[model samples]
Target: MVRFSYEGSSERNLKMIITFDLVNTSNSDGRTSLQDESRSGRPNTANNDWNTARVDELIKVDRRVKRKEISLKLDILKTNIYESVYDKLGYRKVSARWVPKMSDEHKRQRVEISQILLHRCQQEGDETVE
Candidate 1:
């Protein structure tokens, strides 16, 4: 049909045909509908606000806490712990150290410090002074 004319690979077209056939058969048999049915399984509860807050607090207390340690302490999977720390809390690791993503204030401070050091070096007129 014109609706199926959208460019797609043969594999995709085959899958669409199979899905259509399955849906048609199910409808004819009155077994199911096209709508998604509720799945049964343990829902993802590790990356919630409570866990995020807990993880943030732990990070604040010790920025170098490992993901494995957090997973053990919080009873969450390592992947979930990583997601909470990085994606949700906006943290990244540097030099084997966990730190929050730098904001504008941090950038400004870094630039200010470097400029001050550079000016001091220029005034000293000695490049190799320790």
Candidate 2:
């Protein structure tokens, strides 16, 4: 059957969109809408398998290595996956470090590197090598 549906809104300016949700009800089994019903029991979570595996690898490595290495591995995994390691494991890998905090030594080293860079910038302004 042919049906015409019109929807519009007026704010600041004005806009209108005419949506044609055409329905062939004669062969639709008495259905009038165009949406299909979803199946019950948990949605598909297949895409997260890689992250889950990475989390497992991290856990296994945690028993044999330091936390910093695990943190770096987690960063690599995130760079490659672009998603939360914990969320991807069907909430199973809760121990995965999504954002590992920098250690005091790491922070100190970063500060020293920044200071050295600043000194270099100041020196470049003060002298020219011939």
Candidate 3:
């Protein structure tokens, strides 16, 4: 056992010693470690596949839907609902409302349309657009 001390620790002067579990932990694959084992992180209690699909469908129906509204309607925590929309469903707020990330095809079409407008402006001048 080895005593480890931190002079600047603010946790009410907490101190500890090296334990056998940390020094000789043989993981199932036969690895010893002093670090925490891998974990799946926070549980996806509400932001699982089902909620993700629901969030997608809801956004499709109403782009102006708020996170709080989704939380109330789906009875899910706001944080989890937010994760489903932003992280899983790939949505971001634009003009105070969520907008789905554009697909590659949609982006290409937008670029093509912008190019056409640019060409028209060069030929006809900016005043002619209005």
Residues 9-118, candidate 1: write the lDDT tens digits: 77556532221356667777787776767899998888899999999998888888899988898889999998998899999999767888988999999999999888
Best-to-worst lDDT order: 1, 3, 2
Segments of candidate 3 deviating more than 4 angstroms: 1-43
Best by lDDT: 1
Instruction: Report the Cα lDDT for residue 109, model 2.
Output: 100
How far residue 7's Cα lies from its native spot in candidate 1, in Å, is: 26
What Cα-based lDDT does every candidate model obtain?
0.82, 0.54, 0.81
Question: In model 1, which regions exceed 4 Å deviation?
Answer: 1-43, 127-130
Q: How many backbone clashes does every candidate have?
A: 0, 0, 0
Superposition-based RMSD of candidate 1 using all C-alpha atoms, in angstroms: 7.9
lDDT head-to-head 1 vs 2, winner: 1
lDDT of 3 by residue, 52-120 (tens): 898788888888989899889888999998789988888999997788799899999999999998998
Q: Candidate 2 or 3, higher lDDT?
A: 3
Over the stretch 5-120, how does candidate 2's per-residue lDDT look in tens digits? 44455564555555553555534667656687677998645335665586556655553444356447655433333343334432222344334445689899999999987788
